[model samples]
Target: MTSNPPKNPLHSARLSFRAPESPSDDDFFSAMVSDIDAYMNSNITNATVPGSKQAKKYQEYLTEKTLLGVVICLRSTHVDGNESEKPTPIGAMHLCKSGDGMTHHRSTEIGIEILDGFQGKGYGSEALTWILEWAFRRLGLHRVQVRAFGWNVRAIELYKRLGFTEEGRWRDALWHDGQFWDDVQLSMLEDDWKQRAERNLDR
Candidate 1:
């Protein structure tokens, strides 16, 4: 299997951030149209697929509210795992920033979704680590925030392990299987990440 380092996950390897291309009708219909339908029809709470209803609505709201046009970063991998050519997108990370010049102490929200069949692998953790590092370093942003349902222990643990602290808790936030669960709000600051990164580097 191909291997890459998780520490300081981003290296000289080429990954570019660009506006989500003007989606073709099929892309829009598939990602936005279909996702909306799924969200409305199903009781899923953490659906993150692009064409799902929840994703589409969130996209619309984010674009209108933030005006940062969804910035997406894609991965390129060689089919042979050796030769370098067109790289297939194995994952994506979505980002939006505050329009006002309020800087790090302002508001920005991030959403991350890995393609189906890619969960449980370390890819999500690596991607998040690199992106948060970039946001704190390149963007000069102070805070990065995300939300996940309480039942998603994997995600919750991942965020916590990355030094994200619980900022808010909404009890009985989601209803499913004849019961309700909490929705958690998590945030990390540049200071927090810097401290953690320094410790890791020292170790």
Candidate 2:
């Protein structure tokens, strides 16, 4: 709930997004991302063991999946009454392709995590918007998609607010916290993103 962003963070927004660059960054990610509570609504299936060499394993996973990862850090130019000399890693996001020849060139999926302390601080939405823009406009990607569990109402609504249209759902595909949950798929196509951009400009 406090502002402690470093000056000149990457990606040119309220926060920074870069690939993990050091041991400390990995440590921050391993510790913050290994929490059980954080995954309460997440659809990720692999749970890295705390205090393990998660970074290497994670990097391998990304390589195997051909995923591009970015670490989310505090980067602000606002007068939030605080500052940090070094960018603090608060969360991470990834862009992944399906690895199929048909879809690899045109589409990717996005996934993000906001540290527990940073939740509800408008960080997640901002990060997603930036990545979606980068995917469509910068990377020339045709489609960007995301998957959220039905039980995660916050995420479902956030994706909707960001112009992701519901594509379909895998009914009762996930079992977590003592019940079945639907895995909802949502996406934003290139034309859709362009249209949304025009609408925002007209606003």
Candidate 3:
């Protein structure tokens, strides 16, 4: 019988982040689209249906413009230790410049989406840690920001716990589920990230 190869090494305790080779990772992108809830669709992107033209277009745009785009994968180890299976892509995260010119050169916006099955598993936090390190240290960015619906308490809490601070809020900006929700803006400065790193080292 043929034996399988070992698992991919670019992984944390249970999650991995791999670069998207092209916009054609249809399976990965479709999985994310299928798992996004209505509220998330409203706040993140309007393309909800998998394999739709809009979704494909957006995927292409993201891959083409992304400074960094990663496919979030789940790793599994074999019992016998003979071989491990390849990680399965469960979601994605992207970091892109906010705009052109020197004024926006030091700022980037981040976006992330994880499938329903992988939620609440610390995978998002792990991915964020890796992305933030790349953003501040590798890419030499000064500011990183994300937007979330006020009703997305889970995401807001995660961002706060990771040292992001609320920068602003747009009142009743998003209309979803027959009600309006605030659009909350949160950001972390390079200095703040440095302080966080120092604190972690001390701990």
Candidate 4:
């Protein structure tokens, strides 16, 4: 008999998280690349700014990194049609370790992107919350950090609402559109997550 695939981690509502099993699954590669490009190019002051190299090579990069356990893939899913239907990928979140050995074991950086039509529907928040829980609880991490472009107000707001505190801003770190944008860093510590959990219990 064959073993079953791993079960997905369910979130508060519709979103679910799973590992990407294959690069050939249901337009996953193309869709993910498109989402990355769309996110990078959105709200730009100049139309000619190029997308990141990672966006161009996301398939090979994600596959290799994920297999090496340097990155945890959070494939966000949602059900459609009926309960018998398999959930579809709506977005992806990734938590990447900073380096090898015990020195970097307690810290990780997170990145998330939701498909264009799926933004602002609470999916991003749910996905982010689930990943943070996994990072701190399951992985026993001391801190989780994320960086967002300065002009991405919506993303910055979501990060703040989810208990990440502003660590610092790298002045004019990203050159895009006709001007440079600050790369804002935010982080949540293990203590911070515990406090947020307590507040939720109190609610």
Q: List the global CA lDDT of all models.
A: 0.59, 0.75, 0.77, 0.67
Decreasing lDDT order of the candidates: 3, 2, 4, 1
Ranking by TM-score: 3, 2, 4, 1
Give the TM-score comparing model 4 with the true structure, all chains together. 0.77
Candidate 3 per-residue lDDT over residues 67-147, each given as its tens digit: 887788887778764228877777788897555565455888888877777788898898888889889988899999988
Winner by lDDT: 3
Candidate 1: Cα lDDT at 62? 39
**Which is the leading candidate under TM-score?**
3
Worst 10 residues of 2 by lDDT: 43-52
TM-score of every candidate relative to the true structure: 0.67, 0.82, 0.84, 0.77
**Candidate 4, overall lDDT?**
0.67
Task: Report the C-alpha lDDT of model 2 over 113-135, residue by residue, as the tens digit.
Answer: 77778889889999988888788
Q: Whole-model lDDT for model 3 versus the true structure?
A: 0.77
Q: For residues 1-203, could you state the per-residue lDDT of candidate 4 as single tens digits?
A: 99965554543456656655553443664565556454583323224433444443554444456312212233334464234446666666677745566445578888776777677778788877888888887878898888888878888899999999999999997787678889899999999999999999999
